[model samples]
Target: MEMIFIFIIYFVIGLLASTLGAVAGLGGGIIIKPVLDLFGHFDLPTIGVLSAATVLAMATMSLVKFRKKGHKTDKVVSSILAVGSIFGGILGKVIFNIIAISLNMPTVTGFIQSATLALLLTLIFIYFIKKDKLTSFVFKNRLIILTIGFILGFLSAFLGIGGGPLNVTILILLFSMNAKNAAINSIYIIFFSQLSALILIALTTGFSSYDLSMLVYMIIGGIIGGFIGSSIVIKMSNTQVEKIFNISILVIIFVNIYNIVNLLY
Candidate 1:
């Protein structure tokens, strides 16, 4: 009975997180970790593992829905980003293990992650607010986009996020993609990054003993939630989608700030 109850909780949380993630182009990890942390049942590394699994499921389902709806995404761009993210994900996993597991300095790592997140979100928020004045800049070079993908993947893995927010924002700023298309493409890019990070962590740490029953439940919920969320996103206008994305970033910024302060004192 107790086990069943826990599974139910995880499923519900996954549903909510993935729904928001699908709409906002986030990987749901940003939502999931804070909720799970409140349970006090897992450590940071374990939370990272579980969240990555959930994000993979969410991204996969969201991408399928987006493609089914005939949402056009640049296959060439997606391929380039995926290739870059693959390598970046591996590097991020190595760093995460070194700082959070090997060194056993989770608090310090949390401070670092939250601080960086605060900075990233602040800049994104400012850009969204002042985008009109900013001259549109589109990178003609595929190499530059690939490099940006690598950096986004590294940050996503290191911070245990789905890399959606960062991916979407960069796509809009660098490629001048509208919000709707950026959100769809972001999910595709996130699929590669989160999957690579999961594999790397599994290979290095060996998940032989960590019971993933909860993760399985979360994945199930993520699939269902992603479908529904994508449907809603498909109906919304680009402007509305951009607003939601920016609002989510502001919320996440506050969350990161709180985490940073807690870690410091």
Candidate 2:
């Protein structure tokens, strides 16, 4: 009964996260991590593993759906970004392991992590506010796309995010791609990044023995929710969809920072 209850909870959370992720181009990890933390299961490394798995599942589903709908992405751009992202993710995993080994104290580690996150959030905010300028600059210099892709991959691995938020923003703003194409490309980027991160984690951390029953439940819920969310997004205007996603990410960043601060002090 207790095991069943836990599965139920995970399934519900997965459904909610996947639904939001599908509509906003954010991954289920962004939502799942905080909720898991609230429930006292907030191991960052473990969450990283779960997040990568969730992203892989969600991205695969989105890719199929987008393809079925006749939405195609830029193969050349996607390939370049994917390659950079894979290397970046591997590097991030290595760096995180080093940090874990070097930092013996959890408090110090927490402080460092929180501060770094705060800085990242500030930069993200600035990017959004001046999106026009950033877009112009990036479009003029296509090389900037590779740089952003690499950075996003590193951050995704380190932060255990789906990388959709970062990838979608860059695609739409930097590449000046339409919303649908940007979203499709984001899925492709996320799929490659997740695959690389998963391999890194498997090699470094080994496989975690999570409850298979719970995993199946979450995956099923995620699939259903993803379908519903994608359908809803098709009906909404691009401007409205973008606004919702940006607001959701802003809220998530602030909440995560607060949680990190609380954990530290």
Question: Which one is best on TM-score?
Answer: 1
lDDT tens digits by residue: candidate 1, 1-265? 9989999999998898898889878778877776665565777887888888888888888888888989867778877887788888778878988998889998788778778878988898898899878876677678987887788878888877777878887888888888888888888888888888888867777886565768888998888888888888999999999898888888888878877777777
The list of candidate 1 runs beyond 4 A from truth reads: 1-5, 209-213
**Residue 105 lDDT (model 2):** 46
Return the lDDT, model 2, position 147. Answer: 69
With a 3 Å backbone cut-off (N, CA, C), the pairs that clash in candidate 2 are none
Model 2: CA > 4 A from native: 101-115, 129-144, 208-213
Q: What lDDT score goes with residue 46 in model 2?
A: 57
Model 1 poorest ten-residue lDDT run: 33-42
lDDT of 1: 0.82
Span of 10 residues, lowest total lDDT, candidate 2: 133-142
Give per-residue lDDT, candidate 2, residue 238. Answer: 76
**Candidate 2 lDDT by residue in tens digits, 95-172:** 776675445443454455555655665566566667756533235444665666788888767666667777777777
